[model samples]
Target: MDLTDTVAVVTGASSGIGEATAKALAREGCSVVLVARREDRLERIADEIESDRTLVIPTDVTDEDEVTAMVEETREVFGCLDILVNNAGVLRVDPVAEADMADFREQVEVNLLGAMNTTHAALPVMLESEHADIVTVSSVNARHPAKEGSAYTATKYGVNGFCRSLRKEMADEQVRVTIVMPGPVDSEMRDWENWEGRALEPTDVAESIAFAVSRPEHVEIPEITVSTTDKLR
Candidate 1:
């Protein structure tokens, strides 16, 4: 699908890969909707891009009502939606036995449920479009679990399952579903201090996302895994 003139809603657009994706899409001539709890950050990003090509919507994806309103406002402003990037996520790293229940809940709410809320709310508008795409920023942890990161990995696993199932359901609808899994990246969500190898930059993942959505209307990129060569598994 050509990104020119297309409208894309990118959740967690406040920072990291989400931020990069919003900018990348804008550069591709897309009308990008920046969604995140940080209105100020969203506004800052919006200012850097063409104002008319971006809409800043301060939203908490965990809230179903806010997510619904987000989609409604996007339609109200852009008239149609072409891409939905479910990128809002949180990571609470701890062993299962000692993990805080609240932290676990937070991860599940933001990483898993939040994606569902936006997808559910945006499906109608997307299906109405000539061609649409649902691209999710998942993690390599979804496939390879780590010892101390059970909760975070679980949420990603859930996200992976959801996207795969949704992809099958939308196979005949001209709506493409894709999952971009990245290894450790230097972002707000990760601390690279303890790492031995260089991490992939947010723009690396962003470029992958841009490539996936830019495919021909007949082709669908099911998944893309990006990681630094030194960081195995």
Candidate 2:
């Protein structure tokens, strides 16, 4: 569908794929609502965009009230919500047996529960629109678990499952749901020692999201797995 004048809410928009996706959508004539904890960065990115139709909502996705407020504010500012991108995530690497349970809980809270919180808030708004889409950023680790990354893997795996079930429930509403699995993206979250060489750029993943949202109304791209050609197993 054409993104002209469509409204999109992007989580984790302070940097990385979320920031890139916000800019990409803006370039496509979509009015984007950028949600993140950093107000200064969000404003900076908003200023950088060419569109006059960007709203920066400083929000913590894990907070239900903030997420609900974000959804309400987006509707008030943009008039309609066409897309929701659940991209907020965190990673902690350690052997499952030796890792701190608190760290594991933190990862689960942000990666899994965070998405759920945002998605739950956005769903009602999306249902009221003519056509809507939900795109989630998952990791390849969801399917290919690493020895030292069990907690991270578990959260991603849970996100994948949650989106799948949500898609089935929303199918009749004409709300398209897509899950993107990217491998070793070159971001601040990656550790150089564990992940070396060229990794997928944040913009590359943003492009995937743009492509999925830009497809014809009758077309639904459910799942996309992207990895560096060199990293292919």
Candidate 3:
């Protein structure tokens, strides 16, 4: 699990947790691939990292074809895949009875299915590495439901289930699966500026993710729940 010279792909690299993760991994000397729908933003983030070790591949995780191609390009360019950070997600706040079906569907597609698409496409390449890690960014909502956020919570719950199942299935394999759940974060997806309690910064979660993957090979950190001390229950 020495991140030095290892290859890592981070989705949703355009902003927030993904951006911080890309920087954090780079600091650990891992080569990073940035994937997001915004090519321009990716380019900007790329400039802040070690250019020699950074690759920007604009991708829509919801599209299986695009995700598959992204993995292929990563392997072709980097020669191996050691880490995958499935951080791409969207949030829609609304009650089920009054919710827009389209919004709910998009949330499911981007938050749940997007992780599946990336995982499916990256598995084969990741297996070749001596040790690999798949870190998915889930939410506390997966375990605790939220008002006007049932649709969003549903998607997180689905992803949590998928990751847990995959973790058991891959237990004997070299790949390690870890789920990172953050209580509330000030990110592009949500505005926590007015919250009465403290909110986690993206780097806080990034460090948690980095810590998860940097553990000794035999020590598995299956899940991490990060929340502000004053967070509302």
Candidate 4:
């Protein structure tokens, strides 16, 4: 809760974990910038923020130009960005042989490239800040792949790999990187599946994300894995 007045950008903030994380950040007194493709949803969420310091910028993180402009505009409004939450993602489930190329490509574009694009743009601003953090929303599937999860698994794996490498790259800088892997969160992404068991709520993962970044400046949590205990998956 030591983040009062700090600036944070949360992608995929229109719904699910991203939306929850934005609210959690705001509750911790962070000035949040909501980034996603849905302006109506973003505006609705922004209205609920108590700080009156939220910026809703409709963005497709898969596009580098949009991400670039997003960061630039965030700097213009907030002067600097202290935290970046790379939570924009999509899910595609099927065996590799049965996979549609379009679905696979879409997954990669949003889950993998979107995080990369946002991180690419935010790193420069983060480095200049007195203290900064980058928290990526991966999945437990990134480490434990499931059946019928070829494309989705691949993107989460890429997320895991990318964040690990970036953490090392930013180790010497004030900026720190953390990869958050959660399993079966109760969100639209999981609802698409015929998943019937209990699932972690979006707020669960959001709080985990908040805890990761709330650590003292001298302590950096590199990875966090949150999953349901009784899901019996």
Q: Write the per-residue lDDT of candidate 2 for residues 1-233, one digit (tens) a residue.
A: 78998999999999999999999999998999999999999999999995689999999988899999999999998888999999998888887788999999999988999999999988998999888899999999888876698888999999999999998998788799999998888787775246655799999999999999999988999999988876634
lDDT digits (tens) for residues 100-161 of candidate 4: 99999999999999999999999999889999999999988877777788788899999999
Q: For model 4, give the 10-residue run with minimal summed lDDT.
A: 189-198
Give residue 69's error in model 3 in angstroms: 0.6
Local distance difference test, candidate 1: 0.91
TM-score of each prediction = 0.97, 0.96, 0.97, 0.96
Model 2: how far residue 102 lies from native, Å: 2.0
What are the clashing pairs of model 3?
A: none
Clash pairs detected, candidate 1: none
Q: How many steric clashes between backbone atoms does each model show?
A: 0, 1, 0, 0
Q: In model 2, which runs have C-alpha deviations exceeding 4 angstroms?
A: none
lDDT of 3 by residue, 13-36 (tens): 999999999999999989999999
Candidate 1, backbone clash total? 0
Candidate 3 stretches greater than 4 Å from native: 191-195
